[model samples]
Target: MRQSVGATDAPEVRPCPECGTEVTVHPWYVTWCAACDWNVDPGAPDPERGRLAQVRRRLASRHGEQLAQEIEQGAGGGRGGPDRSTVLAFGLALLVHGVTVGLCFAAAVLIIGGWHTGIQPVLGVLLLVAVAVLLPRPGRAPSGPAVLYRADAPGLFGLIDEVGAAVGTTGVHAVVVDASVNAGVRTYGYRGRRVMFLGLGLWEILAPQERVALLGHELGHFANGDVRSSFLMHGALRSLAEWHAVLRTVNHDSIVDWFLNALTFLPRWTVYGLLHLLDGLTMRASQRAEYLADTGSARAGSSGAAVALLDRGLLVDGVEAHLRRESMAAARAGGGAGGREEREAAERELWERLAARIGSVPESEYERLRRVSARRGHSVDDTHPPTHLRRRCLASGDPQPALVVCDGPRAQVVAAELAPARALLARRVIRDHAG
Candidate 1:
């Protein structure tokens, strides 16, 4: 029988199949035969089903394995100049921008030269409006309802800065904390200052070192020069996607015309083709960037801690299920009346309860989830390699001591700084789920 969680600290004794050694595994979390390291990653390459998706998945798997092997074998990074992929991605993005500029110039001529002409001026104004709507604009820095400015969250900000410096980049200018089970960094505003987003669902469960690993992984994107995250490339991709979405929605019922349908086909398919090509060109670089980011994870938080952080991604389903149960049990109390006090109580207990639930997850559950992750090619999305592969990439590397540490005293300060955001998010979660 699989053991339930909340067990004693005693490690379970298991025999290694290969070495016949007594390998010890923990109750709450364990994987593989320690003596021989058997079953650490026993699965074959992840497989894909369906036609087109199958092809894409195979390509992704190939890139993931290739990149993981390269990093594992201590491959050094590229030379400072942009590689072929980067150059192509940039060139394609410029072409996209050039098309926009050409339209803008044409519109300007029509507007300016056709000043006295009636229909031409109207047409010019409409054309310019259409171009303006389609033109890509830089996204502003994100702000959460409960933002934690550096002044208010000095400990957290300081730790992030230290990680950034360790990873060789300027730290984030602002931090937005939300209730998502994810974290990431993005360039925001015209100057492209970095902004880090912290999601409490994941953050609340991480050990201090794992949290540092998360920070390092995110900032590593900047340090490693992720092709997808750049303003030009990202903007182009988003613009193309938006254009695809918009064009796909345009339809003709044809009271008089199938030609209207014919007219829309060329531009729509062109955008689709360009989007596919650009994405394909950047695929290898993006995958490589992720592996390199894992290196950042190791550099800041130690290889063991970085790998452990990846392991945590597998348990999010467990956490969310526990949350639904908690919400049903507590948020629905008082027979749908006196909700204000009930919500307050739920908010007060939110983090502690979540901590206990996650803490109680058994190692067997993690082992099962790992298998599920392997079977399903589970990830943040297709953009990320499977969690197991990421773990492999880190595990394959040389063990590194943490270059940036988050100690107990500093952790407390960081928690205190995030307290208000916690309360607001907790309240929102309870309110949203309450029946």
Candidate 2:
């Protein structure tokens, strides 16, 4: 019989297959064989097997043996390495940055050298004039957004730590609670601190294990270095966009202005092409990262719970959006903000309805969600794979009991831990609608 660990100081011992040393299994789903430096997931299939095996082999050849091994071992939830497209995108981004700087310098040189010349002086003058129109001025680095509330409950923090450990990383540096119906991990601070934003809207509706899966997905981004890379890539793209925006804003006042604008046209178009190319090129990596996160959730929680959470979470999002619109309409009809107590009561009812629906979601409802997702397909802007693909990937993995038997005391504690954030978000809705 397989032994399971629970919340306690005492760890369960299991023998490592590679060495005779006994491995300690933690409650958070990590089993490390210190003797051989091997990390194992009790819930996953053997690393050498499954539909992902061929992809792993291809990655190993292109990237390196070590990287492929780490991904297979579930490092960062199995994000093997940057594919060919990712490599090309980064290379082109660096080249583009260099070209922009070169353009500025060339313009300055032309202005200095040809200011007193008559040989093609018009061309040189126009190129010089284009500099002012094309360059983006430096601005202050963006500050982090303010959090409406911070999660202080010990139980919630403990849960965060557990999910992080399962994905082979330290817990996030900060956990902020917000009113949005989504949760995400982002890099903050000069040191690239991983700050997790947990939406109270989702927390109030998810079961204990589903919460674990959700946390796992966010934490997995940190493990895979997805958040850090995302920050750098986006920053680069934004810089290019700023330059493009400035160039576009310059009006053609006369023949000279039109000529200067035409002079800068090629580079501006290049920037546009790069942005669209990056979006397409990075889609594969983005989709793979999402799949790896799903695996992370499954290893931390359960496959069945992870899949079910995706379905239920989608349903809840749709319902919450509809209800928010209704609340806003009612507020407008009444010509005033509702009382805090009244808003809170309505929010409570919303949660109650969500929980009831998740509990008894019919087969037809799930199919409907799948059909909708299929019709939408995966757009270039989408960061996640199709919902059906995610479900199929987890289902292909090692089969475990889909539903975990919820222990009452622990579930109650988790719910209580989230109470403060939920209450805050409730009032936020009322204020938003009134405005």
Candidate 3:
């Protein structure tokens, strides 16, 4: 039977597949016969291999690859990429600064160049008007039903049950929607509460343990009330940043622009400097939250499995690249109205490009690059922490600091009761749908 490395330390005597020499199988080297370096197929039906295969299957099921595919098809077709939302955030910032600089420049011209005319004041007012137009207003608070959209209803239900059991709560409801690799917890409608959105892509690439880890993290957001706080903070920052950018831009080309430009050298440096600083702070906070979620996942289930899944996730191209590409694509499509569809498409493209670039390198080389990227301060206005940092932190396993059961007692009971039924189901599903 397949045995967990964590379950034992005693070396088990087994024949090496290659040399047939009696060799001791150590817990750490579960995937290969240490003496001969013979590869072990984890999915093999032999009892020991079957155990590893089951773990792999569990990881795949939790990750929801099938669901991710379905969502991609529904959201629009092809492997969904990032689109407008990413660009809009940048675009909005640009527009705000452009207007501000222009206004300031005009004011300076009037004061310094002695062009104090009625036209100047009118121009100033117009610049202010433009600033008002460019910045986004605060969004309405989320409320209403807790809906979760997904492609695999049964699988999702099982996951929800697992999460609920882990957290000591009744199961949450979910609904599947069309989108690749995106998920979020939202509060919407008139009575604002909690709802979850599961994207098809999220399930596509993650193993089961990673899926649980992700869910645990999201659920932690809900539990900690961080979601609302993030929304408010982001809205306020965007609004203030827009206002400042407008003021800065309106001053450009005017006498004020010359003074400020002389003082600052480059207007963009001044703006971007502040923006990057704020983005970094926010990213750091988000990273910490991610760690908490990882802790929660470990509490809910297998830590090693969760870590393995997260490592895999790090390999997937991130959402930012997808967003960038999507924006360019939508711009090309001539649907530049800044609607939801356009925004989602833009975000997808941005992430897709990043993923493509990263995927081009060999796996071993890629890991090295990722480590280097993490250490050299490579974060660029990202909301999430670098994946390498996340992996390292989770692997340390010291964050939780208390003796809490990784898997819930009730969950274990439920799994024990359902294992037989699930096994039968798995057999039939595999036989009928073997591809």
Candidate 4:
């Protein structure tokens, strides 16, 4: 998934509350002063942090308002604010680009008609070049990479179908298997068909019920219309980024370059400023959608399973990172004619080792995981809430025991069917990381 977050090239200036030193605020609610080493809210305070979080918190306190009503109805609030903000930002950006293009073309006509002098002609040419470079182009639909379909792996595809139907969506169009420790769903083609990417490593480790919760969380986004919202927001951000990239046509090289840089600096800075503002404004909706998805996961599987998945995520991330490093080393050391097969085998072995390591994790280790899970700071790139917050949210919901949503026999059969795709992608992962 192409995750979206607000960005700003220029640091926000503020004074430190603890020390009086001048501080710069970065995205994800970070306010820090280099001289005084003052950081804001590193303790993972209750109710979340960041400007958007504060806004959501205040909105939650009220009753009968649109957002408050959404929350009261358990319908997932926060979308309205972001939806309006995205449209406004996108419209303003298009307006700016349209005016720029119109002026440039009008100037070109004047110069071509011999109605403008030397400096005007030069200005017209420059404006035309700027328009050409800065204009946003349509994004291409991503090509299908390594994937599996119903014909390729009926059991795996059937399992996905069963889960999808259980979660209340029709079903995904296809599945892309990969070798990371994460999974996501994205839309492709004009019809907005869904393609889900599943990580072999994550699948190998999660229990059957955990898998359901994970899938429900991902697929539920489609059911809840998050995919549609994200698409537009991502497009707006990309267009702004293109404009900014076009304006930054100078390096600190020559006097002319410096002058050009100075000229376009404000425009580039404006794009950054707008991006940051959009990110802050949209964050609440994005994060709320995640919680709502978790709710769906809990409903589909069990609350215990959903919360356990979040708690186990810390361990999963650590184990996967370590095993990937080992796989990289093995691939590097065993280079030869049969290196490909060797690397694949090595990666499979490492994956098994990871699974075993996770199964045998000491009780003491969980305490450490708890500490790490509790240590929270806003991630500028991540739209999901912190895992601890997710766990708490699920816990507060209807109680249910942890149990497998899929039968033991079926889970095993699905696992067996996915072995080929898993091994193929695992090797690809090892090779990429080794390089």
Candidate 5:
């Protein structure tokens, strides 16, 4: 996954068995192709054929028994299942859009509405500008060699050791600041040494076992080399969004802005629409990774313990509903009028309204709501998956053959490893507030 390539050459593509879409053959790649929701080989030969063959053989073996029953009952009635319906709906949507655009063009000529003569070109140019701005910048790539460690924060050093040992990798290093309930592993330094960001809030809220599970997930990212690849992809998208934002801000006085404002608001809706699309894709992937992480944690520790931790976290956090509200608030704030303060007030009002709709609950319930808000949902910007699905995955038990060990020594080992980081972080909290 960390194999570096020079700028001069194009990466090779292999057809994915899952979707039959051409996917880049990279060592660290693990993604389903967008065209078809198939399990892709990043750089390996087609496994789909083999997989299908195995399935056929299994079906053949049971053909006389289960197949006859299934046929008699007409169980396998649908063609390609709901996926076909999804594809058909998508095609119809595109066709409808095309027809609508055609109709609009025809209407523009017949009616002297400003939408026909002036609005269209400005919208087109704004989109072009957005594309130009949001595109990723290319340069000398960051290497993955040197380890950069930060010990300034409390529990900073101990957290590193615990997480490093949990993942069985010495490739961990570096610390970054994040205010949100956001913490994760990443590659850093000139050589791209793995780094982990342990969020202050996350550390404060979750219990020891839950923390370990979270750390394990981060370690999984590092071990799998997902950090570097994600960095590159996310960096590109962030760069483009930033550029588009800057350009939009600068061009506020331009005719393009006016045209955009005329057409159900410019760049805002367009940007958000793109973000929602990306968020949908990301959420799906995140959900899958969450399941894998739960399995990984179960393998590393106790499945029962993992499940308990997830259940507790979900109960304490109330993460899902809270995140949904936050997302709605953010969207409202972004689209609202007035300055920052005014928009924030409006967002707050919206939150209050939403809370009111839920009706008055106990203090405990309110606290739960707060926890949910703090956890947040799968955002277009988020790297990790949602916590609810993670809990479900843990509850589902290990997906493969695994043992459930309740040994004291192993548990003690994990506790001992995590203690220093926890203590250090706790002290850091005291010092910050004390000052």
Candidate 6:
């Protein structure tokens, strides 16, 4: 975000507060010394707005600090097999699944045994409906535009496979490329084939080594045995969430509504209690799994790259803001989605442009972001430990050589492979701005 003092005015020079370095003050952008990084993030981070958000923030902070302490003391080693908490959480999850199973069984019995009774058919239908609604739905393999199967990009897949081997896992079945500024891994379909999502927003901005770090961290989830992400636990938690969602939408205008709400209150509260318990039981293990994933990133891409990978996350907001501004400016100039040629050009050039834009950010901006993280407990998102702590944890580890390296020549092939994804995302961005 840069601006001129005026069309004819020269940009002003400002002295740094922390270090008396003379710095050029670009209008509308932050004024921080490249030497000392003072007041780059001058405003307070917005407070989380609601009780649930506040609780999540506190929990993330608590877990981050505690896990960092454990790492410091060398007591955070991975334990094989399910812990007591994992066992108990799974037991509770099974009970939740069992409730829906029982409903289906009862519906079958009622429908079969009382075929002549009109009331039994209605009751059975209701039970069946409830069972259908509560049944765990298996995720399907990701498909459609921009979804890259292994055959489509062997170089990318080969790189991923090597990283997977380094982290004691196998290659992902598919790769989903999207515009989101994040990445994640998940299982899909009955076979639970794993796929990884790569957000080009994050991907384009990463250096080759950091890209390996990103892949290492996501693939590490499978090897690390993060039970919370397993189908059984995640399915149960998702089911319970649906239950809560259904229970909370009370219709407020009738005695029947009041009666139904009252009748379901106990079950609703019970489900709520179980959800909290399962979350509590898994929280520590989940946090530790995250740290293990970070370690895997370090091993796969070197500790220095792993730390830098996390540091890159701090630039997400700035990157996103720049994208929006670019989109808007292009739209106003009658170029965005206005002509086929212009749109095509953007499609081809956007990734390289984005990479260049973020790559050019000054050192002071990153420094400020690091300080802001300490003040605000910021992360890539709530699911992560604080970025600062993740960096510290990576720093504490012994430095190692990269298991998977994507050199300049190899990266060009991967870029050529991603041409389709680049076009798809560019068209979307341009069309959105056109609207």
Alpha-carbon RMSD to native, per candidate: 5.2, 15.1, 18.4, 11.9, 22.2, 4.1
Give the TM-score (vs. native) of candidate 1. 0.84
Q: Which candidate is the best by lDDT?
A: 6
What is residue 266's positional error in candidate 4, in angstroms? 1.2
Model 2 agreement with the true structure over 1-435: per-residue lDDT tens digits? 112111245567888878868876644334556456454323233346576766654553343323223444455344456767789877766665566567677766766777777654566566556544444333222333324222556666666787788877777666677756688877655666667787656765678788888888788777776521565466556666766776573676888888888888987887778777776566566666777787777877788778877886657555576447646743554454554445555555545544554455445446655655654444435667668767766776686552323357877876786676565665566557744
Off by over 4 Å in 3: 1-158, 164-179, 225-231, 248-281, 318-380, 398-435
* Candidate 3 RMSD to the real structure: 18.4
> Residues 1-435, candidate 1, lDDT per residue (tens digit)?
212325457777778878887866764454566444566555455544679767776666666666667666766343245668778989999998787778788888888998888777788888788678667777786877776678888888999999988878768888999888888888777887778889888998899999999999999988888888777788788878877886773345664346755676899899999998899788767777877788888899888889888888877766677567656655567366776676677778887778766876666557655665666663323567677878877776569899998999999999999999999888777766674
In order, candidate lDDTs are 0.77, 0.62, 0.46, 0.64, 0.44, 0.80
| Candidate 4 per-residue lDDT over residues 281-360, each given as its tens digit | 56556666777777667766688778767766766656566566766766665675666666656667755655665665
lDDT measured at residue 159 in model 5 versus the true structure, 0 to 100:
50
Q: Which pairs of residues collide in candidate 6?
A: none
TM-score against native, each model: 0.84, 0.67, 0.42, 0.70, 0.41, 0.86
lDDT comparing candidate 3 with the true structure: 0.46
Q: On residues 1-435, what C-alpha lDDT tens digit does candidate 6 reach at each position?
A: 223112233458877777888987654357766676566567866776899888877776776687788875568856556667778998988998998898899999889988899899789999998888888877887975589988999999999999999998998999999887999898898898989999989998999999999999999998887877877788788888888877874876999889989999998998888888878777767877888898889889888888888989888887787677656655664553445555555556667777877776656567777877787873324456667787887777678789889899989899889988888887777657854
Worst 10 residues of 4 by lDDT: 1-10
Q: In model 1, which runs have C-alpha deviations exceeding 4 angstroms?
A: 1-53, 76-83, 250-259, 336-342, 378-381
Q: For candidate 4, what is the total of clashing residue pairs?
A: 0
Query: Residue 220 CA error for candidate 6 (Å)?
Result: 0.7
Worst 10 residues of 5 by lDDT: 1-10
lDDT of 3 by residue, 1-435 (tens): 212213546667877778886765544333344344454334233322567656744543333333233322343121234234333444544544555566667656654565466676666666556545544344355332222333334545566556645644334444433233566665543444445655434443444455566566556555433421444445435755664564453456789778765665565566666565445334434434455555556555456655655665554444333433444444454344554454443343332333444333334334443444343322333445455655655565443321222245534543444343333332332222121
CA deviation > 4 Å runs, candidate 2: 1-77, 99-151, 227-231, 249-261, 329-341, 347-350, 353-361, 400-407
